[model samples]
Target: MTNNTQNGFFKLTKFEFTAIAIIMISPLLFSWSMYFQGLLIIVMLWIILGLSWNLMAGYTGQVSFGHAAFFGIGAYAAALPYFHWRISPWWGLITGPIVAVAFGYFLGKLVFKLKGPYFALGTLASGEILRIIFGEEELITNGHNGIFYMTTWTSKLPYFYIAAALAIFSILIIRKIIQSKLGFYFLSIREDQDAAEALGIDTVKYKNLSLAISAAMAGVAGAFYMIYMGFIDPEVVFALHNISIITILVGIIGGVGTIWGPAVGAIVMIFIQELFRSSLFGLGPEWLSRLHSLVFGALVVLIILYMAGGIVGDWPIIANKIKSWKNKTEGQS
Candidate 1:
């Protein structure tokens, strides 16, 4: 994940740098289908969400079931300006994260007092409360009517590059954080909060910090979603299963604590999701599309049971198995 350096700060390894370079130039290197390009944007969006959830739950041990609240706030941050004042929604990119972070700070103050499932339920309720409040406030939010606008670009290329940049920025920021003293504090809190407190760490402050960062990342993704999709409703942005649950799955499937885990997870998740939704690119039976939810649920169960640490987390085990298979084939020959 990191290259050892004398100053105790980590740098990107050569392989990591090469992989990033390839990603940056991939669009230019090949003629990709428009569908593939759009899928790339979705993958980046999930990457941001995966990183967001991983920061709070994986690093800090504060599992949240309400990230949809922050995502909705971010989308509305952009949408409301356009809806109410005819202002450009682009401004929401700056304001969205700020608003989400403020909300996170307040929420953390209330929920951090509770621990374990109590905390999870508290956070979960926050998203549901927001959904109801937004849905009822037709005067301000237009209720279930939602907001709609035209996207700025006709081509997907611009959006693809923007999403890719955001994904890269998120990866670098997370990498830096995890390599710093702040990351150590987060790990300590996760391992044992009481012990961290006894060691003079400000557990509350660090936890809040983690939540704020997580919220900001999720908010940015929401802002981008609104800008790209050019439409939003309380249901679409705040859906517990779609936005919040998918974000959690992205993190858990990618390898919760590793740096590149979410990146890989996002890629796998988006492809599987799109493949199923498209019903094998329209070649499969219509029933396949309807079975996406069932298929995804089964996949998640299998991953959890067989690869508890996730793909990246359990890579060594996987590698050994592959090697064993190769050796057995050689012996048979």
Candidate 2:
């Protein structure tokens, strides 16, 4: 609506362009240090997950609380083939998304009839059911004992590059989607479903498509996650809590409807968590580790209360204030 054609990649605003440039050059700048590179990789993975969730809950207003279901399904889908059939991870990478998309399609169909909080609760329930199934299905999921991926000598560098590439690609895909015809439909549906339907938009079809895409992207992230951790368990893979935490944090902190907001939120939240873990744990404080969640929870509450628009949303207001001050100073001078 605002002539976004002029806002292409090369034409990005200064803030956006600078961020992209930094990401593009990070591998080269940090290649000498494995610690930084590893941190970057983990951050990239979170970015992928956050972006996937943002597409569904942020843009489409579907508010799915069960993304971990797709995440776990993809991890298992990839791991099962490698463990039992001796299939290459290359194949698993492709198949994982297919499986996740199919599952997500079914889930969207079942839950789209509900709205708002009920839909969120339904998805949460669905995720919990899947987690229980994975834990109890000993023959398939190894019954919480988990499977360990054989380690390789390629080190974490390759993984870092791969994760970074995937993050960038996923962002690009989301940007495209947000700018497309379908994005308008999504926005319409999010604002008012009945009004959107009155306009002849197929709300159900678009919602399902959004869910499918979100699940597929999440599945891709999960596939890489197994490779990165080299181990998987029902608790880590299928936990409903993890899904809610990541989704809510990313969406709230990043400015939910924006394309790159989730990536920004993921980087900030993960860095904060890492800093707390490192600094607090090194002090040998018993309660610090336990208090980490409390701290994060408090931060979330404050943000929701005082900064509901999130980091990106508040940024422009801050910038405008700064600019006003600068103009007044210049006039006085």
Candidate 3:
């Protein structure tokens, strides 16, 4: 866990380098099983979303409840190109972020005027509005029937590698940004906007900047989703409960304000989701499949009650508690 910063923004750490290596080569051990590969790709997608959301909400303190706006826009940006006339969906990796940032800037102009929970609610409303609009725009979006792509590959291996690359790239970029001076400005604004303003930090400008960057990465994830999954509907991409709220929970459960928190959170959330969805590999009852959402709610409640700062944030407390219990048992023995 050693880090060396070169000129503030170009530093590398052993942990980061090791993580990349493990992610790149670990699938070989499983012999690239299609199921595991597909599952890993989904995990990478969520990692991207979690990391993107963490940038603004976790680091910059502008929590958004409507990130689905960017994700759905990205998906459509990639899909529409192919669906309308005849263009490669690959181009979406470029246009998706652009459109998302455009809308994100527009939304930022309005919502950044509000603060705290008001800002969160404003984002929630904005996401819902976009979801409705996309759902109704049959001519342009193909409505509830959704958009589908032929897909670039039959096997999940290629998609898994691509997703892993994306996840790595995004993590590096965000890490650089957070370690730079801009990262400090974001923190100052988050800690106290009025104080940051008093210090001449231009909190409004920085908040918008954070939003734009966050939106871009999220849009990229959305576009990636469209490509990987091959089909998407308004409900699937822009759903409040699934996309938006899950992102917030990822940050919260992972450990807000920490660079690695959302990553951990995304992994845990997705694993738990798959656990319930698969019904413990057919050992559990089929009815349990329907209880994933309920399990998520329960997990969140438990985390908040006992680990207010999330697993990573509260790791010391948890470790100490475990140690104390172990010592007591040893003494009794």
* Candidate with maximal TM-score: 1
RMSD of each: 1.9, 3.0, 2.0
- In the range 160-253, model 3's lDDT, one tens digit per residue, is 8888988888877887787788989999988898999999998888999999999999999999999988999999999998999998898888
The TM-score ranking, best first, is 1, 3, 2
- Could you give me the TM-score of model 3 versus the true structure? 0.94
- Alpha carbon deviation, residue 178, candidate 1 (Å): 0.5
Q: Alpha carbon lDDT of residue 52, candidate 1?
A: 89
The residue-by-residue lDDT of candidate 2 on 182-209, one tens digit each, is: 8888888888899999999999999999
Model 1 agreement with the true structure over 200-260: per-residue lDDT tens digits: 9999999999999999998999999999899999999999889888888888888888777
Number of clashing pairs per prediction, in order: 0, 0, 0
Where does the lowest 10-residue lDDT sum fall in candidate 3? 1-10
In model 1, which range of ten residues has the least summed lDDT?
1-10
Q: Which prediction has more favorable lDDT, 1 or 2?
A: 1
Sorted on lDDT, highest at the top, how do the candidates line up?
A: 3, 1, 2
* Candidate 3: regions farther than 4 A off: 1-11
Candidate 2, number of clashes:
0
TM-score of every model?
Answer: 0.95, 0.90, 0.94
